[model samples]
Target: MEALFERVFVETTVDTDQDGQYDLIAVYIKRPKLDEKVPAVFVANPYMLHCNEDWYDLYDVNTNIQAYPSQNIQREDVTFYQKDPVVCPKKEAEQIVENSPYPEPDPSAYECISDLYGHLLERGYAGVFSGGLGTRGSDGLTMTGSEEEIFAFKSVIDWLNGRARAFRDKTRTVQVLASWCTGSVAMSARSYLGTMCIGVATTGVEGLKTILPEAGISNWYEYYRHNGLTLPAMDWQGDDLDILAKYCFSRALDPNDFASIKPLFEKNQKTLQEGEDRQSGNYNRFWDERNYLQHADRIQASVFVLQGLNDWNVKPDQGIRLYEKLQELGKDRMMLLHQGQHIYTYHLEDSPTLGLIDRWLDYYLKGIDTGIQNESKIYIENNLDQKLWMQEEVWPPKSYKSYRVQGNGNQMIVDDLSQTIYDRKQKNTKAWLDELVLTQNAHSLSFDLETMKEDTRFAGRAKVSFRARIQQPTAILSAMLVEKGKQVRLTPNLDGDENHSFVFKMEEKPSDYFVITRGWMNAQNRLNNYSKEAIDPDTWYTYSFDFVSNDYTIPKGHTLSLILYGMDVDQTQLPFVVTEIEVDTASIVCDCPIE
Candidate 1:
């Protein structure tokens, strides 16, 4: 493809540091060289164009290279390194250039999205790729999913629609306008970028025709902690926001910009610390802002939500819950659930995801009669091994049966009897990250299902209600649905000593055990997920919590097990309390589609 439009750094309308002056955002634009306006597609994310590992290695480090040079001018004649005299002093930018979290990106570098945008330009669509606030060349301190972060996204679309202002240079001398945009836009991205799409879409921003958020989070609370239980600790303890800021926030910068950005860093850090109460994992207004689901009714754009059913990182619930909200609002939406883990469908061989996006964009942005609206609302890969994909008009397929299983000592039975004991002192098994405890623990209880006489799939969250008594005042519990059975295992069968990317051999063998789904809760927060209440020691209370949603099949003869245990390690350092659980086995039933 040929260079069609010059890449320009467009400053957005967000003063992230509350510095009165607006923060600068970098945008690389490409489009057909025509007088007619075109619809635009861009992936809004904090990871700048050149941050991808592949792109970093593909391009040379040229701090002075411009992303898009004038059509008539040679690229070698222009210097890309333009400093902001007001916000980005030369001394600060030089220091940041020397020592930043991420090496400053060479403006000329191209990555996957850049290539994708090139294709978009060829299709007569404009493509604009912008780095998130606080990223390289973009102004402001990064706050992963904060309101300011989301507002930055809205500002981009506003710019396209002529409602927002954007500057072309550091001094705001050259005003770069989105004159080539038709005021119709679509946002597409995976993971965090996708998250930005959701955040912006909820605002019902004008000119945003559609959004495709793959594995994007709808609730920040759900993203980090489940219900009341925080994820296990590795080195850090307390809120997940701390961990997110530690990893995703952009601290890397140009030395010329560092002096202005340093104070912003300290301010953002202080805000994060004060905003998210690390002492308690409960929800607050801070989390409420991040919870896009609450504002789902405000969404005006069509949505194509996709997520891996088995994805635990962002969790399937993130996208699934949003999909459900969109449905309730009678919004134009479609959902695709596949049998992968936090992956993009385009990465899969011969996937139709791109085609779907094209059709969706066409229908919304171009008003083309693509008939995407008539298509099935939901598509799921029913079985991974068989590669069985199924479509339905709605999620939680209506044909599924609900079977109530009661819990007996070491056995899951059809009988319903109330009250089972969960004596925490019974076992001292420690919890690990995302892994089920295969071995029996005194602090845990496990009930097993009989070998399946027929192939059965649990396609949704299993409702678990039980009465429990705690020896102490507080306790955190992890419940997991596990499958234990022999299955054909595939291992790489290699020839010679070389491991080729596309040329891999496989050997099949028998293996046992796979963790299907898991859920967590704090004992005191049994009634409200966001609030904690004191529990009297030895007083029996009926606690109800749902297991994480799943779509997994237990082949005939395989046994399914429900294991409950206390998580010793936690992000919030709450004192460990012993818990005893009693349950009516009949109250525990898996509600899902079988076929």
Candidate 2:
């Protein structure tokens, strides 16, 4: 096993930093030594290779929203992001000898979960790991979701298939061939690594068979922004594409590599920052290039989507959009929406939705008839019962029905819009919900929904529409649908478990409610999230959007309610601006899928 392990650099076709040559991708090969060729499982990730010394640092969130634009945004601002890459400087690239310019790759980027990859290798296949272009040992700049970045990942598979070149060392003297493997490849991982799988699969690159994207991102725009509002992932305030790119610009770790590309890297940062559109938070060519769903027609590979329904980091919508697209295309695909947070579900118990991923890969990568393809298209974990897994032939289930409520009386959120935002810095969700249900507050609007007579299932997204106008030119609009009674819920097991799985726990004294799902948007982005036209003060703007997809059963006798609030403590950004919202209580419309 030791003798078969080797590190190599696969040459890519682009020079993201344009330092006079095509970029190189750093890869580590682990294939079986058997005479019979096997398939390969490739992981093209930025996190596992050379990485930034530190994680993403927050940007200044104290600033106010961008002033409403008086006119349509400049065309140059949109088209510039789509400019073609510069012509390769190196018609015939110069050879970079081992350790000549960049240092060796540090394998400590990921926790090296021997349990997962080790098992795959034992199944008589090769496993390849790569920190895509612009990581520590690789050339180019780290621009997430760029065409160059996607092609660089595809380049590794090209190497495995003998269509691209890879050198055993920087000398470019001895070549490392994937002679022990078949051309078929599958990419399987969680988070950004999984997202790369979607990006590469969209290219429809030959020899790439399938992908298992667990908690992967399909649209980079949605990841960083919500309805024209800068909403960074997790609790990372003020984070955007540039900050994320800077975080993965791992090449800076090597002194020699850093010095050679310092100017280029700095320029890359400036370009990224400018294009990210942090101020307007509107979608542009920058976001469009990163949206893999738009190119779904090019995907030839089978896809198996796995996402944590409770995951906010990558969000369920990331997997939902791509999987639905594949379903619409009549492509071979499957989806496993689990109750866990942002995590891999292979180790989670198999009512066998995820465990079948092994079989799915075998069918695609090794031409095995696993019969997994004959199974249902969707497998969703029951949020009410973590151990129970359910399957459905179609989304929303056949029995799905809509439950809705309209605003009864107008209510106002008391945050002062005339002044800079300071009141919403640390809004508490639970406390806010408590006020809405137990002690009605002036800062939010709550509508009591029909109570469920029997245990009722809700699967799929919930849409909220309402007519509202604020005292200011712009405001943040947020909504939530909740179960007004306590229920044991699934929570992530963060106690250092090997699986990083989930556990169902009931609060000693169950809380007042559980927010089924929620959504937010910059109210000014009414026509679409990509548009940011100024809203006339006191003019009614209709806001409508779907909350994150969810699957749960509201207990019998438990009432449900639709809560409209000024801020979402978890997802939205801080300035609880907007002095008051003149809401048409009767204008609130909810399309809730109940089964």
Candidate 3:
């Protein structure tokens, strides 16, 4: 068998001076003959052409390098050597040379042709190159346009694919792995190429903003200057990047220390016009960008997104909604929400939520079927048990049952019972109009049941059906659940002020041991139509409605109580009212037979 290798050098000139000296030089190794069986690798270098002395020293002594028989070719067969390599001017080389002696060299420095050649050969990769926008020496990093970046990425794939046909005459599938923003751009391109793209969120210009702020540095450029950290010219940007960097740095500090600057990031959430501020626009933009609705359709990969739920800038809801959209789009994707903010943290290493991301990515990328695709696998920490609970269905399952509210005196029981009441309007039907003023502290009337013979479990949605005449034109109805001799459990109100009959759905409750479900109607919407089985919409009627369902387990000794009331129950919010009312059991049944 014969081995083939080709060496090529690229010299980039900044000016058309025709001088022998070139502004930049690059070396490349092409093994077009061996392209079929190996992965294509590209190493890019923005500075320097030859191997650094340290790398040469390692090459001379390291057993790993010596063990590779293929890399050590016969001296006679070696075709290329630089007789008198042009070096950078002494003054310019001083800074570059001084920083070269560090224990660990910048990974970018080793992106030369020979270094990349050795890496690919040692790793058994066949395709390799060292050209891109910067190959022509036009400030490769920043000066590289988005189009050129796209082209460079495509060229790498093309070159590799080209080799497969030329070398082995067999077509091979290619996969790409990119670092930094290059990964983001490459992944975007991969979407067009119909290839799977795997990339790392690398440290680069964006990283500087995050890193510098955490280090207590107010200004990124200033920090670099004072700390002697090398600033790659490609990292340099206009004022937008600088401003963003400063903003990020300021936000990195604790809110207490920088209370004044907090408003800059915060959005004004007030509903009234008088409370409006600059934060309003900022918030709108933030929500617009962070909202799942924005990129609901753009995601093309089997995205495994790991976002910090506690991230101040990017809320957990953002990722949650994105995951939901992906599910809606029927894309193969997963999302992991952790307790840490913005970036992954070592401090949270021992945290249980931290491993969720690792497990998810491992299962998706590594082709390990870890059962992550199961329906609604939300691992929520149970506040009661302090352990993660895996739910098969959605969080707070929909199979809850609501027990209709029935009353004997002030006592409430979970049962179905009819109450004949006087119609307030006609004052003729077996209905009585009882006027109750709507107040903030309006007591929710309850119908208590007789002592239970056996325990019962009630879990699901609960509601209250009532018929009453409103003295005023409009009012608000609110319902709440309360354990016997305890405060109200969960309270939710109707959407708006109205004078009509309607059914309100309580937010789903977790399965638990409980006695009753309760309901309430705003006295203002007291109009009810007794002609239909449900309350009427046109005119006021007479009947205090208590309808509750879902599911709850009643212990043997506990009594089930149903309470109905009018007015907003959230103490922090404003209040409303309800007028006349009559209490009765609502006759609504679940479609599915409850056990």
Candidate 4:
């Protein structure tokens, strides 16, 4: 498709940094020549303009977990911020990208979204891209998923509809306009870029007709912390909201810009550090601002949620939760689930995931009558067998049943989990399974389910509840469901073309055990994420929480093991306290979903 015209400009947004000067957002636009204006596909990402080669700044998680008050305390939860995540920035701008994360993206990063946008151009649609504050060409601090970040993105759509202003360059004297756009916009991207799609849609932004967020986050709290634990999203530890903000602070890459904004940028980083509350790992107003699920009621756009069932980075739960909420709101919504780990669905062969997206956008953006809205609302790559796809009106399917499994052994166990279980660098999961689940640790307890009568499909979080009398004021306890078997687990397509992508490979050595799901809680925060009260020593209290969301089929003859332990070595913050808890086995029953 030959472009009729293309332009790069800057749009102004509120001074989230409180730097007196308004923040400048960098925009790149392209459109196929046509007599009539056309709808546009939009992408707002921080990585486009510039990316830090390295950003290691993180909170000190090795420090002791903070103690709760004798009585419960909940921070004033700020669901909607009155002010943008007031950031800090000083600027000298640059020039940048398009409807994709890159006009020409890294091959690894390039996928169906870019391809789809290019295809749209051939169909007479336009494409536009922009970066928010603190990106290389944009002005303002990068607060990661801050309120300001969301607004900065919304402003671009506003600009396309002529609700806001844009200048041809950094100097505001001359102006430019997206006169070629039809005001209807759709957002399509992956990962962090996908996250921006969800954030802006929550505002019910006028021009946004639809949002296709692939592997995006709905709640920053759930991303960084879970059930009151500072859980890292696979791979690295110590990476928090502050570190993420630091990584996207690309305006500093320019030496002159760095000299001007370093101090203010550091100040913004400090605010993030304090607001994130790394010590407690509890939900607060700061996280509330980045959460989109709570504001789903405000969304007026149709949403196509895409998720990798095996994705550990963003996890399978984030998109599903948003899908569920949209369902409750009775809004237009659809879900596409795959077997891949943190990957684009463009590669899935049998289903042709990207084709569905093309139809979705065509219907939403152009009002095309594709009959897509009448199709099954949920689609998933079956885990029981690779390359097989499944579709139904709802997830967990109508055949879903709960199987209860309980243990009758001793419940009293004590161990100081603050000590390291392995050399810090030794993060091999098979070894962790050996040391923490299969081979018994003095501080952990494992109970087994009867062998499966048939190959049952297990899908959804397991509900675990137990009454425990603890001797400590504060403690961390965990529960996990492991599949005990000698079976090869099919991993999602890694990097490969379509023909080779469908050929599945084993994720790990065929082993005797594989952990299916896990749940952890700060015993004090039994009521919810916000409220926490120190435990009255020796008093019995019931704790209940869902295991991390999961979808898999436990094989026939494979017994499911329910392991209760202290301090998750892989997912929680550490406290150096020698703690003990007496559990009532009768009060413990794990309810797992089955089909």
Model 1 Cα lDDT, one tens digit per residue, 1-595? 4435444445555677666677777666666677677899877867664442321221111111011111232323321222233342211121111000123245454332424455566777877777777776677777878777887778889888878656554555555567778999999877777888999998889999999898888887777655555552222333366445544444343556667677767677678867665445556666676888988999999899988876766678788889888888899999988766655565343345667777888888888999899998987765534246677776666455455565563322111111112122332223332233455444556667556788787776665556666655566655667777877632222222221112122336665766777767777667765666677755767677776676677788888777765553322233322245544444455543454
Candidate ranking (TM-score, best to worst): 2, 4, 1, 3
Error of 1 at 136 (Å): 2.2
Best to worst by lDDT, what's the order? 4, 2, 1, 3
Candidate 2 regions exceeding 4 Å error are 1-3, 53-55, 73-114, 350-354, 398-406, 416-438, 494-496, 500-508, 576-578
Q: Is candidate 1 or candidate 2 better by lDDT?
A: 2
Write down the lDDT that model 4 would get.
0.76
Better of 3 and 4 by TM-score: 4
Higher-TM-score candidate of 2 and 4: 2
The models' CA-based lDDT, in order, is 0.63, 0.75, 0.28, 0.76
lDDT by residue (tens digit), candidate 4, 1-595:
7675444445555685565766778776768767777899888877776667677665555545667885455456544566734433434334222222225334333222345566678877787767668877678889889777888889889988988766656665456667778899998788888999999999999989999998899999988988777887866567898887888787877888878888888898899989888777778888888888999999999999999887878978899889889988999999988877777656456765868887888899888999999999988777768667778676556343454445575477675753435543454545565777777666777788658989877776668888888888777889888888887777665646542344446666687776788888888788888767778876789999888777777888898888887776666664567788778877787878774
Using lDDT as the measure, name the better of candidate 3 and candidate 4.
4
Distance from true location, Cα of 131 in model 4, Å: 1.4
Alpha-carbon runs more than 4 Å astray in model 4: 4-7, 74-81, 84-116, 398-406, 416-421, 493-503, 507-509
Q: Once superposed on the true structure, which residue ranges of model 3 sit more than 4 Å away at CA?
A: 1-179, 182-352, 362-371, 374-376, 380-384, 388-390, 394-398, 407-442, 447-468, 483-538, 541-561, 569-572, 576-595
RMSD of each: 12.9, 3.6, 25.0, 4.1
In model 2, pairs of residues that clash are: 97-170, 98-170, 407-585
Best by lDDT: 4
Off by over 4 Å in 1: 9-11, 49-115, 232-239, 246-251, 384-386, 398-439, 489-508, 568-595
